[model samples]
Target: MGEVNRRRFLERMTALTATAVATPATLGAIANAGSRFPGETRAGSRAAAGRPDELKLPPAGRPQPAELTELTLAEAARLLRDGDVGAVELVEAYLARIGRWDARYQAFNTVVSRDALEAARTADRTRGRAPLTGVPLAIKDNYFTAGVRTTANSFIFEDFVPDFDATSWARLRDAGAILLGKTQMGPLATTAASTPTGERTTANAWAPHHDDVSPGGSSSGSATAVAARMAASSTGTQTGGSITNPSNAQGLTGIKPTMGRVSLHGILPLTYTRDHPGPLARDAVDAALMLQIMAGPDPADPRSLGLPPVPDYLGAVREDAGALTHPERGGAVRIGVLPGFLDEPEPPEDPAPDPDPDIDRIGSSFPRRERTQAAYRREVATVEARRRMLATLEEMGAEIVALDFPTHWEALTSFNFNNVRLPERSEIFLEHLRDDVRKFGVSLAPWINGLLLPAAEYVRGSRARLVLLREVLDEVFARCDLVTQTAPFPFDMVGLPLIGFPIGFETGSTGYPRPIGGMFGAEPYAEHHLLAVIAAYQRATDWHLRRPADPGELRPAEGNGGGPRGGAGGSAGRDRSPGRYDLFDVMERGE
Candidate 1:
């Protein structure tokens, strides 16, 4: 092992020993639990010995082309399988929807309708038995697809096309999935979708006319596409909170699987060790199915080397959505709730009011306090909504445990977090920095910060990460089946699995409903547990079923363009403060 790897292992061993001493019973149970590797199927894991030949279809019915766009991935696949809906018809439905709605929502950067139709025609002839066969998906722009314009929404690779598909996309494609197009993303997976000139592109499907509501970042377009029924489902890559934040913002179910769950072979790098690719679906069951197909070891990515087999993620949720809530599978699910997670975090103390940095000048036109207050109110409503949801789960015999985050959570997430990711990001995009830094636009400041970060600080931050990971695994996860109402930082740092699903909606100041999301995180390779909880929560609530109003039918308010082109909702000259989480800022200003 390299020196750094050795040190990390030693630090984890020391922390684990201390953890075992502190809570012998809890540690004993964790120890008794076999391999935590994501590839290993845990005891009672619902996955069968080999790929099952069963068709997991839902109630069969054929909706009109426009209506068919509203069906979840599994539903669409079922329709195609049962012969009630032709694959060509399904593809045509989504293509038509994208043609009408995508122009307004700006969800897709590139829509290959011709290719999708051709794939659909093939599906109709072959009638493939794969779970995702003929299902239309919007892939994040960063994921490389052979012969597709795989722009990371950046000028650097605007014309770059790959010779082979990204492992994640390849897996989905080989499973008979059809790509509708590459969805827009934050340039280099940093912020909201914007042009080389810094104009915003995508809008939240829930309220495309309301500039006040953000679609969420990096994976914003991916989430918007599915939420607006433009695609059956989509893929997203999360380096910080890219997948979870957008999934939360758009009222979709997004799973950021364990760090190495899905191979990142052909995707653009953000934070090498941090980047996680997963699916964004309309609901938990769809998310589970998409994840199952996309996850596993890939020869292209050494990080994805031998671990354990991908567990039966779809079966875990499908067989019994509420199985994790009851002890029949093992112990009744223990959900860890961090106190004050829903409340706004305490802002950093400022002794001397530092002059606002120049980067702060480039942001939205909305007043800072107004936007902050709105986000705060939304969080308050989110807390109440989640409490009610949890109450329902508890009544169903689920256990909700109050747990404190690690002692250094605030410090690690705040100051030290940036140090860990920035250096690597700087290294990855060093050429861009060396050539023309201005091209980075709003993302430039952080890139420069990473460039200037001290080597010693980076090393220290890297070492501290192992300590934090050990604490999360040994301390927090030891007692809970999942962590509820999650924050993305520490969990991202520790490389655990997180599932984001809509809990409810908070009415925005503009009288439009803004999606409020809840999350559940589990130990590495514990996606089965996370999916089980979310699937059950979704089964009990109709929040995931809520779809945004049709953008084409809605008229844009005066001064705000009806499309994503130019509007009051644009992120023009406004506050560019770093988000609540230092890793990736999708929610700080709610854009």
Candidate 2:
């Protein structure tokens, strides 16, 4: 077969693999709708509550135990294993914290109190066993969990529940991990903007500074929950930038394991070619541990290729610490700095406003020149940051070499198009436009429906674009151990780890809704190990340790200069039921 045919064949295989991996719940919804679901439709329960504007901020009070909340997943596991804390106690602590805070922040859509307690009970039964036994976790709503309402933050699947656990969820559960319930996610896990605009726009735990800004989509809830200490760790998925972006925005550590590192079975799909499942946590060690459990092949998922014997991520974490401490052992690590990736070109000085034919057709005009200038300024900032980051690494005794990939700029746009075009527009047509347009006169019907034709065309265009981008990336990765670039601004400002934030500095004003970052991936499987390295760096550094400015507060004592008469010692009343309940239940008549 010719190269084009070969690529087409591979793409088709990937799409088939994706279709095969989706759970029956998701496939059933698609069959009923006559089209695949959009990210918006599968959105978690939080999105079902309302749009972003309707979300009310959680009431402010004294800061909750941010430090305790920020413990790494591994540390939490050790504490549980050592009897320093019981599973039930840990669950209750987080439950109380969520009650005290999540409403304002909208970090979770559903809290499985019964399931959590049962899991905790199971953990207690298995006391003194299982590395992660009894440890609480939050799964992004996109992952399938049997009998749980796994909404993708969309109305289409608002009532859909899966009958089986996603591969990673099953592994974690088997490992004695307790599920705290499904966290919120972007509407269908589409654009990064979805992260901040879902049913309950998840506020950056490090917000006001990071809130208001996009929380990084698709995995927003997962990142926010981990950051806010709602869960010791959480699972997140990425098609383009979901996991890493939210991780960056929330100042947590995230890994986007290479395409097949973890089974994609039982998750909602954006694109089959790029979808990956990984972990988001307070630090690298926790992420690594989760990755170890989640990694490995599954016969159920055709795309699951056997990973070369999985290493002890905790061991890798230890190795990273040793590498940092022993410069002689680390020996001038060669980091390739992608300068072209850094020097994002500003659009022309006198660019036409509303240059896009689509925008012009809509009679909307954008400030083209101002947008160009803004792009230039943002690129300048990105380059400067890249330089500083290199300096920081060099100060730590690493060698930095400048590398260039002129084609990298095109890669981001290409990836973005592929990420959204087909799935997004397909749902928009079927859900919103088709029926309405079909009601028009027969003669006008075709013309009106023609507007929806772009969706299919865009999908085809995206396939071509992906081919080009993938080829370019493959070439760039051939010579570099790792290509380093500034972590995106939205994430950098919040002090999140960048190990996997993509390169480039596209401006939101320049039609990109978020600050794009550079990436370092070589060959098809390079992102896998590169991300591991990024996790390792974070494991060795304090960069991901930064906390939010106002992590919200704990409700004060009633008698001591506080509102409403309550108990002292911050002990919010506890119900000893085997089942867990939130403040909402306490406030409401329901138990």
Candidate 3:
């Protein structure tokens, strides 16, 4: 074992006796018993015990509708701008909701009730400078929030607080956005748990009672917080599918901005090449509003394009850029589509009666299913939804461009996370890990402590990825304003900006509800075009407005006994095909 790995094992030996490996049955039992994890309980179920916040749900000290928490950020923004609601009342409404329902969802790691109230009060007395003024928002725990405990949902830095804000947070603060609290995140912003340190398991809002489903990760809590309406919007960082995957599971609209569009200063790194801090919200316009407020260049982070002047993203959305005449096509858009994106692969011709040959040989009852039939129902729905969306675009004069860049699915799975990305992550984080040990308040999450690789392999892999993605993206982008595709995409490898939102949901024989979303991509700086297309669709559709089943309402519903991957586990991979031509494929074929 490496030096760091040895020390981590030694430090964890004493605590090992107190913890047990979680199994499906134990997890379900723990959730059904009302405490999903230790030190946590459902909404309004507090008692005389741990922290004061755990004691009871407090009143907001103001009059507000219970449904105010359910309002979209766009709706709330209109009221705030039109003088229908004051910043303080809006803040109180959100606080009351958090105090009431957030316990069940367990979306936040820390609730800054007092600080949020003060900020809202200031917005009422001062002149606002930006679009999201007085709009309450949740900060991801990984982002640096001065004076607040910005633990990255990891035990290593449970008490660590930064003296400065990430550029994204600083910009939001300057815009008069109220900070509700730091929402939970994947451990060290790299795993599914917000805090797997002791016994804190942040449950998904869609299926709180069962272990069969997930809200998605590593930005698991951010998407859930917004989907469950605990916050108007929340920031989520994506290295792979962290933003979009959770959005798909929770039925929320999420944006993974082009890399470096939002400065990463003070935020923990997952992959320096792929990490993007973006917003998860109600719809495209709301996401556009956040982009306008949070994006821009910061000299501190050299990766930031420092684009001379940021565009008026909100204004552009309103301008209906998707409807604008393509100079070449004249009042039409060219949209790119990959037909196989969302479809289930056809079974092989003349298939054997027993497809599960391995299972039969091993004497098992059945072959392991990777995903649920309920999820496939949504996938089929998504495929149909994309076709309808395309028809609408064509009706409005969009020319469909069939695309054949088949390498993406391979890129998603084969590229770095725990493999190629680990060495670079370790180089950047080891010092912090050592410091984390000295200033520790909780246990170290295993992945961060155990995974290490040589820097040579990491660098070599990263370069190849950049080259392949850049070429493929250029080939497809040249023919379209925005490229639309289905889930399980590999867009993150090249840091492409994508807007992910649910197309539809369905229930299968299992009786569990499944949600599926689609991705809209544009080359790096073309976020505006992508937003325009999405905004145009959103204006004509209500998909983004759909909400998931409330966590508080999750009961013992009948579900099929098969264990579906359920889009949890933070897994991303491309489908295997002989057709795609990646650099790896070329090396193998000697082309």
For each of the candidates, give the backbone clash count.
5, 24, 3
- How many angstroms is residue 116 displaced in model 1 relative to the true structure, after the best TM-score fit? 0.8
Top-lDDT structure, candidate number? 1
Ranking by TM-score: 1, 3, 2
| Candidate 1 residue-wise lDDT at 308 | 63
For model 3, the stretches where C-alpha displacement exceeds 4 angstroms are 1-64, 127-129, 198-200, 306-308, 319-331, 345-369, 406-413, 416-418, 432-452, 486-489, 509-513, 549-554, 560-591
The runs of at least 3 residues in candidate 1 whose Cα sits more than 4 Å from the true structure, single-residue gaps closed, are 1-60, 319-322, 325-329, 342-373, 555-591
Which residues of candidate 2, in runs, are more than 4 Å off?
Answer: 1-67, 192-200, 208-211, 306-312, 320-332, 340-384, 406-474, 485-498, 501-523, 526-528, 549-591
> 96 in model 1: Cα distance from truth in Å?
0.9
- Model 1, position 185, has a per-residue lDDT of 82
Candidate 1: tens digits of C-alpha lDDT, residues 65-127: 556676667656655655667889888888877776666678889999899999999988988
Candidate 2: 10-residue stretch with minimal lDDT:
582-591
Instruction: Estimate candidate 3's alpha-carbon lDDT, on a 0 to 1 scale.
Output: 0.60
What would the per-residue lDDT of candidate 2 be over residues 408-491, giving only the tens digit for each residue? 444333323333333443443354344454321111222333355466665665565565545445654444445554332211
In angstroms, give how far residue 563 of model 1 lies from its true place: 13
TM-scores, all models, native as reference: 0.83, 0.65, 0.75
Model 2, residue 417: C-alpha shift (Å): 5.6
* lDDT (C-alpha, whole model) for all candidates: 0.71, 0.52, 0.60
